[model samples]
Target: MTHRIQLAGHRWVRLVTRLAVVLLLATGGLVTNLASTAQPAYAHAYLVETSPVDGEVLASPPPAVRLRFNEAVSFNERSIQLLDTNAEKLAIGTPGHVDGKANTAQVSLPTDLTEGTYVLAWRVTSADSHVVSGALTFSIGHPSATAAPVEQDAHRAVVVVDAVGRALAFLGMALALGGALFVAVLWPAGRSDRRGRRIVWSGFVVLAAGTVVVLLVQGPYAAGTSLAGVFDPDLLGAALSTRLGHALLTRLVIVLALGVAFGLAVRHGSPPATTGTATTATAGAAGAARRIVLPAVATVGAVALPLTWTLTDHAQTGVQTWLAVPATSLHLLAMALWLGGLITLAACVLVPAGRRETSRAITLEPALPRFSGLAQVCFAVIAATGVYLSWRQVGTWAALGATDFGRLLLGKLAVVLAVVGLAAGARRFVRRRGREPLGVDAAPAAAVRRLRRSVVGEILLGVAVVSITAVLVNTAPARTSYAPPVHTTVPVPAAAAESAAGLQDASIEVNIEPARSGSNVADIYLTGPDGSLVAVPEVSGQLESPDRDVPALPVTVTAAEPGHYVANSMSIPFPGEWVLRLDIRVSDFDETPVRVRFTAR
Candidate 1:
């Protein structure tokens, strides 16, 4: 009978995991319908407006170039650069704020520039500590046939290493928070479990190491330099000055404090609190230290540790930040407690007690039920916060399929579902065993083995979820990252009726692809009431930034098909309200203007 139950349970577990994977692949429609409608108000920064639009042909150099972003951003002297057509670096003014606006950066241009096409490369740190960089071109004369290539993104290896460091930190955090909770609080023999103590100690070391790695690599990551810059004093100094650096530093300190508390909890959990004081007189001292000192420090450190992450990460920047921060911290705490506790439980209790291999009897009396209760609470917290955070980060239904962040989230949910399935079985076992006359340890050997296998599966799935989450952390939130292009058609101006015959019943159709920022191509089609292209004599274009307080920038519109006009290199200076005005010259004297208004992402 036990064998039959175990086999059926294993098969059921396998089926659930397979179903979870299939559901993940096809869950787009289901998730969108179920997703909450709350959208984040703010996110990462992108170039909103520039003094001179990208790809504009300027007769003379502008005195100063200003940049504006949709959100607050910070930059240093190294944030802006001028590169000539030949890829030679040129000196530019130090980047600073314009009129005390944190989102705007201004740098004086050198009057000596003789540019065929010069690339202005700018890098800035957003509130979330991610560095966004891009390059735009403005020609002094006509657009050059060939210009130097610009690499806007950070080095691939640097990004990968940074991600690895983050994964390690997350893993270490789980172990430190959850392992310590289980060994010191949940399991009765946790204090004396040699293997368990070692695991907790290893967690501290790994967490600290990962934090140090991220701290060092952050210099290169932000500066757009190679790995060699990791040790550069200036780069390191700049990194330390940012909010992310401060958070990492605080995290390290908290890790140290927490490590000390964990050490004391296990060492003096049943020992003299202090070193070398085992006497009865000092027993009172030990009791006070154990009962008062350890718990105080651990509680504070655990609470503060997640704050370091919440205060600098995605949670700190978006809408209802006050709420997001607390929710994210709770999410992290629940994850740490659940994952770390499960790993510790499986290694120290389930495996040994199931295999029945230990010389000392591994009792299941109170620890199993206690951990079961904690796990249940942790899962509840995880579900609540996960739903809220997912809604905040991924606002629209389209974004879930369009952005990298959204896809990663789906993958994470899949793995978590598999883990949840296994966890349900484990919880059921605990509940059923608790009601028996005999203790949980009296479970048949097959039943214990089945429980052990499910737990191992849960741990593996949990780690996979953590890995996906690490990548997700480095990606931009889908709410801000996904931007659809502009496509609209406006009726012909009334003046068109007096200007020409076909123009009376004709309309202008405009399409802009990937219209976020920088260079974009605008396609304009003149279609008559019959829905056919109507040729015009001449078309001249200008980009108007009326809302941004910038002068009109010339756009070079050229003929394509009969009535099709293409602004092959329409440069959008920023992501806000703008108009692409086309002056159509139908005859020698008659000219009418058609304006297409749109918003760039």
Candidate 2:
């Protein structure tokens, strides 16, 4: 009788161990699959380049101003505008029209006008529905001004998409990992415990469902489609062609493989006594084989998911470049362990069982210590890696306050802190009570209940963290600037040509040189004759032949130095030849008209 009893006990232990291993495999596979599926969301839209360069001092204004974006922009006239120094409208024809082929916009200006300052104000609605805008200044007859505006729509959209994808990946990982840990520690003793089975199965279902959502949503989000156009094939194809898409595809394959592994484990994990001796032994061995094989496959999948992302997504050069790829990988792994572990604990361990023997001895008692230890290790890994990744991505302390990316990161940190607090409380409760069950005692029941609640809370916060992460990925780093500054020097002559009468014929020489400040601004210098600085006064002047009757446009000239005048706020009225006549008064000469002609084209 003793021999028979021992044999039965050993068989039962084997069956339970097999079930636990299967669950662990499933968890690992699900996390790897989901992690691969997640994509990065951009926060701001990026402008590739522009014409009539920001702050450019053109000899003559072009027919229209053209701006190009990295991605498609929302089409709305109100979104793009042009104004003068006094904030007057200068966009001659229409606000702007999109160039279908280039994915750009063109805003036309009026034909004839006097020299003056002009402002281009633009607002664009990105494919993601976020609105972004900026302003630039340009001058006429002066050096090109470089004053590129700071625009964030395209970049912001990308960041937001990235955050969402990462968060979903994290959430899926947490569910799968937590579920696996529970089954690994508890199911070995309670393979037939209905509640324990439900927990494990439920986690699998949630993980699979989450993975599906990530796969479907990621492609559209990355391509910057409107919410309504998310299902467009062109956008989807474009997204898939990028590195992010390939990573997601790899993740799907891993997840499907894991699902198959889980099914195999469950198939062989029957109650020991339900089958004949020969069948039971065969099933037991098969189950054991699957346990090893599935988890091994899952481990490979996990490694591949992050490795692909590291090689394809992040920048791999500079002082902190070496750390970027490794830190990102570690960050992903830690998140998976923490989230997956919690999910498993809630679904497999803490759930109530029907029979006292099944609940206490088979499920709760054996699983508690194992899960507690695993949770501790996962928490440590998460904390260590999170710190390193945060440091590299965020850089300076001020970035937290100065940039959108940093702010989103800070929000994620807050969520993590809350999860840690809940986890700590659960750990303390588990430690205080020994694994041995108190017969009919409510203390163990209460502790299990508390742990379940804490795990659930952690999952909720994890969701928010993911959302913020998506937003951050789309936005440009706070330190990144798209526009450059403007620089110019204008020299005027000092001598005047006077008639015999009091009236003077002032021959003024206006020297203009336009240079770019940065990527956006155009700096131009305009000097008059008489070897003295001359300003483009806010008055109307006629260009002799081609633009004879055009009114003098508003001009704003700032004195850069003692004898140099920089024209920042001005626009050439026409592109053709024009004779300029400036009326001025020197220290000793009466007011005189200085005439000069230059081709604007």
Candidate 3:
């Protein structure tokens, strides 16, 4: 029996130690990748058109370069750069809106730019506050086969700090909103509990600090600047002009309001009263506050705080946005209340209750029971909203395992399930041990210790949830980010039969790889009706974007194998609907067009 007990104790210790290690590693490691991905920008804002275009051989540098995105984007002077063949940064004009359109940016190119290859590296913040970066190279006179790749992405330190700031903000929000609610409203003796109040107060301070950090870091993150640029006035101004800036500022105001409300709620050291006021006027004032004032402010602040996040994140952009926004807000609120409340409960009530036999024989009574009930409701809301959100963010069943976003979500869910299981066990302990009215305090010391350990596990798991959530929120949704390669066949034009003298039933098989913005490769196979190779005189193509009013870009198709043709350097300008028009010449004078339509990510 002693051996069994000893093994169990060791297991518990190991579990906690492992959790602590995981928390540290995940927080530090995952944040570094926020800005380093190659292309298919983090948010939906994609570059649909570029002046001079990628790979265009020009005799002279254009007076000004223009870029059009599918959606609004925010950038600063440092966001766009001219890089020489050696990956050296060159002088360029400040990036600005084209025709005063937020979706388009224009920059003046130096007329003295020498001949050779040059890369235009651009990093911009989408409306949802995610940074998407890609490089497009255009040659002044001719392409450089040996041109170096652009290494001008956001500095690693900047991305790490930015991610850390975001994580802190998420943690602080939970404490400010959830912790405050627990200290002021959940526990009866919470008002005077120094530790509990301190935790709640610290939450407000951390939240404010975190918000400030993110605000400061935003300037550099969006501009792809070094950490020192965090305080640059111009960078700061550029960041503030964005949608996320507005949201962050609104959040600060709400935090102040909520903090005041929490302070007032706890000011009445003695629990709220009905007959405590001596005079009629004082009584009436107290009654109004108890019934109306505090609740109104607290309610509004709680509801609005989540909106500040939901509105700015990807949540507000997709289908069922009206429903998505509210569901996400509720999901966030429930998370805060449950996590913050649990931490307070453990620290103020359960911890102080003590496992020592000589400790005060306090009845568990209302605090434990009330919180258990609240937790149940929170879990229900979390479950319902979680399901809807999962479906909304990851549309297909295969995506669950196929995409990074889906896999991360699954990891979060696994941790959440573990938390739920622990919470249930704790609930059972509370009900079973508290049945004698003396509460869990009346039960065996071993039972009480078990309860405390279970709560600790739940708390640790909750922190893990928040850390994963920090990374999860920054990533593009699985549905929007996942793009399968384009594969399809288009029928050969009838005009081709008259020249080739074949008859009918022939088709062109088209394949495009990593069909995203930037460099791509496409393979075209001319197959006969009998599924044999059939050589053609020439196969030339151009890409057309039907969704926009832009001109079709030329695509060079070279022969491969007997019947196969390859567009070895196809560059898709953006993520959207596109058509690859292949003009095949069966005979010199007789040619026909074959259009293979597909979507690019």
Candidate 4:
């Protein structure tokens, strides 16, 4: 009877050991899946090239300004605009129309215009619905303008790519840590029970694989090159030379070292021989503690790796950066733990039993409670961190609808809510009572099946979240394009008076000469009652014809020598009849509003 009892005890130990190994392998597979799926390929829109090249000096203004993008763009309100040096509004003839079925927009410019320097301002809505806008200044002649070029840095891209890679790394760490914890807490004491050792080995292999991928891919990615360029020594050297690169390299070394230490522990610290009750308990505790240490170290390293990247890459100061880093870190870790745990539970606890056709032999009886606890923690972390991250990225409540980033975030949140509902269902099932063959009440087999299905649902939703996140990081911030308005002023001259048959002051001869090409200049030469030229001090006007309510044209008048005042660089808003109300300040005469109609071309 004593020998039979000992043999049954050994069998039970062996069974639990196998279960643990399978769980670890499953979780490792989850980490691998995340590593493969969560790559940063779908983020922001890229500008391929531009016509009348950015910052190129043109002798004459181009008929239209064209911008080509890698993806389709949205033509919404305030999508594109053109402004001249004097802050006078230049007409953007029409909305952006598709160029020959390609993703490009051509905005037409006015034909007749005196130009010194003009700024082409554009706002393009990326295919992902993120709006990106910038200004480029080009001179007509040798004139100088004080506008600077917009700078584009690879910092955001690096952060996004590194985040995805570190997410995978964290997944591996969680699997290894959780597996180690399980092994320590429930160590089987039998020579045949080699499951704990197998799990530890599998975890190490996953960690090593994830580390290699990150180390290899990060170099080329940092250099803004494709995967094929990863092996280039120059690219690798540049990446390693930077602060971000060096930190990532250090993380890789630490992870590899941890893997090595885990392997050593597994080899030299096998469970002690289980001779009797006291020996079995002592052996189990020792084996469990040994298994636990390696994963704990791995978890610490994984958490630190992402934290380092976040600190070095995110430039926001004070509480903003602090809040963003921790929230993002927790968000990443929770995703890994939940996804990795699901995989472990499925592969180790479910697949083997199903394969062996002994569905009842390795029942969900012992595994459900542990999984439920893990799921609860995962949900809490995902929710809390997700809320914090959304708050940081979307500053205003209206931004949720105003910007593309906020919209995608909303979609991700909805999916997460659904996942939470599914988890709730699983929790309910585990708590319910059911009959057992041994006369002990336990969770029904059907409940376990439902729990598995819920986990799968959670995994699918998690994938959607990753995809959304991948695209969100590429978009520009919501508040970048809305800059304050600029305002300026200019002067207009009167038309030269013509000699009539009886009245000499009836006719005025106005010579409209552009001081510079692409600028609005109207010169008016007026003959006074005494046959002397008079200077018009101020001129107020409106473009009256096809379009009304044109911008206020600023006019400035200068005396060419003495009597003749030359109006130079007077801005005209559009092509129409412009009524000039000139306040003629001649000697001691009353300020007169002289209305004159002139057509602008």
Model 2 bad stretches (over 4 Å): 1-52, 57-166, 184-186, 189-225, 269-288, 307-322, 352-363, 435-453, 477-601
Best model per lDDT: 1
Clashes of each: 3, 93, 0, 29
lDDT of 2 by residue, 7-56 (tens): 65466446545544654554454446534533332223445456765445
For this target, which candidate reaches the highest TM-score against the unseen true structure?
1
How displaced is residue 396 in candidate 4, in Å? 0.9
CA lDDT of every candidate: 0.81, 0.51, 0.77, 0.52
Of the pair 3 and 4, which is ahead by lDDT? 3
| Model 4 whole-model lDDT (C-alpha atoms) | 0.52
What is the alpha-carbon lDDT for the whole of candidate 1?
0.81
Angstrom error at residue 371, model 1: 1.8
For residues 262-367, could you state the per-residue lDDT of candidate 1 as single tens digits? Answer: 7656764242233332343345544565676567667667776787777677887777787988899999999999999999998888775435555778777788
Worst 10 residues of 1 by lDDT: 29-38
lDDT of 2: 0.51
